[model samples]
Target: MTVKDLRIELTSRVVMAQILPFGLLILILFGLAISPDLVVVGDARRPVIEEIAPGLFWLTVLLSALMALGRAFALEADDGNLDALRMAGLDPAGVFLGKALAVTVQLVAVETVLGFGAFVVFGAPVARPGLLAATVLLATVGITLAGTLYAALAAGLRVRDTLVPLLVLPVLAPVLLGATQASRDALFADPGVPGWSWAGLLAVFSLLYLGVGMLAFGPLLEES
Candidate 1:
């Protein structure tokens, strides 16, 4: 079942959905590189990289995730194959993991690509490679774990677009704030303790969401 889910995600639709964010991030980064610095800077009146880059990186990541959510369940629904999977002996946890796996791949790919793009465009360097990687990974999990479940809940709803954001944003705000701030601190080497704290929060969110989603997915899908 895991292998089957892997196959579906590796195919074109989900892969493209994953990669589209790279393109969008590139465009945004390019715009920022060339734009007229409308976003003001911190004290000392200097246009600090730390002040602006994190928000730009995070918003791009969020938008890209939003774009992919709509496409996440379509592959299963369009072919009438999700019903078949339910009928099979696949465990509920297996099903959630499969879906989460696909979304996680998509999330990580988008983040990696955009991270590199941010590096190139903003020249944000990692002061501590290990910490930076850990922060990136935790941020990805926080996004993907919650995202997978909401994607499931809003799967067939006509108002999914509206509802998913409503469901995810309030839930995601803390993650976003923590992730953006932590990534900045870890990469730039300031307030490292707070950064680790945010990373810990992100980790907790990921594990909690993963366990809850794994436990609830079968029942959620049964509604469909």
Candidate 2:
């Protein structure tokens, strides 16, 4: 199921044509707004944009993932594919995992592009590569698990395109927060932020949503 969904996503023009460009555009807009050249005349040695690059990077990923989430289920909801899947007697839990994993894969690719943009445009350095990698892995899992679940719930709704952000973004506050904090610590080597602890929070968030999605997806699939 995972491979099937991934193949669909990879083949879709929307994934290649829309999501990546949108993410890069967001990164460029953020760079313009923050003005990488602008620096504070205070004790802080880094420019304001550089200091907040981690948060900006994650925010870009979150917004891009919103589009990816919408696309993930939009395909299934169209052309009676949802009905076909239900009739095929596939395990709902397997379907859920497949879809979530596909979204995660897309997000990881999105993050890599944006990460490079942040590196060059914001001059953000990776002081601790290990912590940054851990944060990215955990946060991506959490975002996709919760997002795929919410996408399933909103699947059959006409307003799902607009409704998904309303439903999932709020629930992802912890992920955005924890990811930003951990990424900042990893990038800057901040002594006070406890990067690993925030990564731990991301792990817990991912696991919590993983169980919820597995148990609830079957019912949601039927209703949608």
1-224: candidate 1 lDDT, tens digit per residue: 67865786766464565457555655465546755352232222225666667777777777677656666776677677777777885887887787777777777777777787677666666766676788778877778778878878887767887888888878888888888878878877654356788889889988999899888887888853
Q: Candidates' TM-scores?
A: 0.85, 0.92
Q: Rate the local accuracy (lDDT) of all candidates.
A: 0.73, 0.86
- The segments of candidate 2 whose C-alpha lies over 4 angstroms from its true place after superposition are 36-44, 190-193
CA lDDT of 115 in candidate 2? 92
* Superposition error at 72 for model 2 (Å): 0.8
Task: Point to the candidate with the largest TM-score.
Answer: 2
Q: Which residue pairs clash in candidate 2?
A: none
Best by lDDT: 2
Write one digit per residue (lDDT tens) for candidate 2, span 8-54: 66666466578988998988888777663632222234756545788
